[model samples]
Target: MSTGPGILAPVTALGAATLRLLGEMGAMFLFLADGLRLIFASPKQIPKILNQVFVIGSKSLFVILLIGVFTGMVLGLQGYYTLVKFGSEGLLGAAVALSLIRELGPVLTAIMVTGRAGSSMAAEIGVMRITDQIDALDVMDINPMAYLVSPRIAASLISFPLLTAVFDVVGILGGYVTGVTLLGINEGVYFYRIQTSVEMADITGGFMKSLLFAVIVATVSCYQGYFTHMRRDGVGPEGVSNSTTSAVVLSCVFVLVADYALTSFLL
Candidate 1:
């Protein structure tokens, strides 16, 4: 009889945890819905959206360039040695280009953007939440979702695919530099194989993936910030910290998971 109580305790805790998680997900869905509705409800937010685009896209360019260059270089270096072993070094450019266009470029762009911009977004929102800035908007009859979040969400949707495209281009160029110059592969052969094998399909599919990932990153970051609450576990500044950390970690996890699903479906 006593054992029954002990067994039920863990089960009860598990059920409660599951419910809490489901509830949070439902709230986030509603948050997204509200943002979507308001984006059209208020078309006058164009300037804000454009500003966010600059912030999300232009500000992240240097990091994207840095990441793209190093990643492509490494891929080229490793890929060359491997292809050389198989006596297929001429295919190196195709291999590197396909890999970047199909996978690494979009995924890495999401990660870098999430780490830099996404965390800042969460922290900003978290601070707003903690300071009752959101409540101030409510008092002014302003829809904060439209004013604050929708612009960012829309901007991210635009920014991520563009950034991924940049990453793809830069990474391919880096791969060419390493494979052709340092690796002593024929420059003409390298570009020819890449141009021949790489297609519009690969580029389009990868862009689609980045667009979906952008939604995940922006939504998760904003949701965490908008809903930050003081609690015993962590609240106030602690809550902000927790929310920022959660936003980044969850964004990364969701991006990787979505990448797998998108890859499976698209490829």
Candidate 2:
């Protein structure tokens, strides 16, 4: 059978795309399974998970707080000026609260956490893979996935939302300070505006997005690290480095994409 180039190109492209998606889907399922297993396995792992969560979540609190403060301040400054031009400066609180709670809070926190902890996880695990520590776990009859991947995932699940909550509080406070102290708006007005304008849905949606971002960050980082085959001749350090870079890049991209999709569906 002879096939023209035009006849096979479309089929080949379709097949490649399908296979790529399937690979991604399979990896996602595996990541989910590993996370569930780790969550359900030993009770002793809970303390470890908490410790990791503290390291990942609590440790990042200062950064989140700083970012939230500046973000809210800048948002307030700009929003107040813009609203003033429209003779609606009173809506500054509503604008800052809504934007932070619905969009900036979770997304920015996710990006920061991914850069801080996600990259570290990938590099650490990638080095372990290169050193055959993962293989040694196989020899010892221990599940590498359970031992390494699960804890990070569980930690992320616990931490990301906590971080989001912190982001929410700090950001609101920042906006309040900027509005009342810096811009000469009434404190009661700013507080009351946000209190009434901010809906439960806004908080819940941000929390949900944070949770999803956590999972995506953990899974993408772990997958890249875990699947790195360092023994492939010239692809040792280079492969591991590439995996680390890919993990960070992919996690950031996935977080933004998921944020948009989730917002569309939920709100």
- Which tens-of-lDDT digit does each residue in 119-225 have in candidate 1? 98999999999999999999999988998899999999999999999999999899988999898999999999999999999999999999999989999999989
> What is the lDDT of every predicted structure here?
0.92, 0.87
* Distance from true location, Cα of 107 in model 2, Å: 0.7
Model 1 pairs in collision: none
Candidate 1 has what TM-score? 0.96
Q: Give me the runs in candidate 1 sitting further than 4 Å from their true place.
A: 1-3, 230-232
lDDT of 2 by residue, 77-166 (tens): 999989999988888899999999899999999999988888888888888998899999999998887788888899999999989888
Give the TM-scores of the predictions, in the order they appear.
0.96, 0.92
Each model's backbone clash number: 0, 0
How many collisions between residues are there in candidate 1?
Answer: 0
Model 2, position 212, has a per-residue lDDT of 94
Candidate 1 achieves a global lDDT of: 0.92
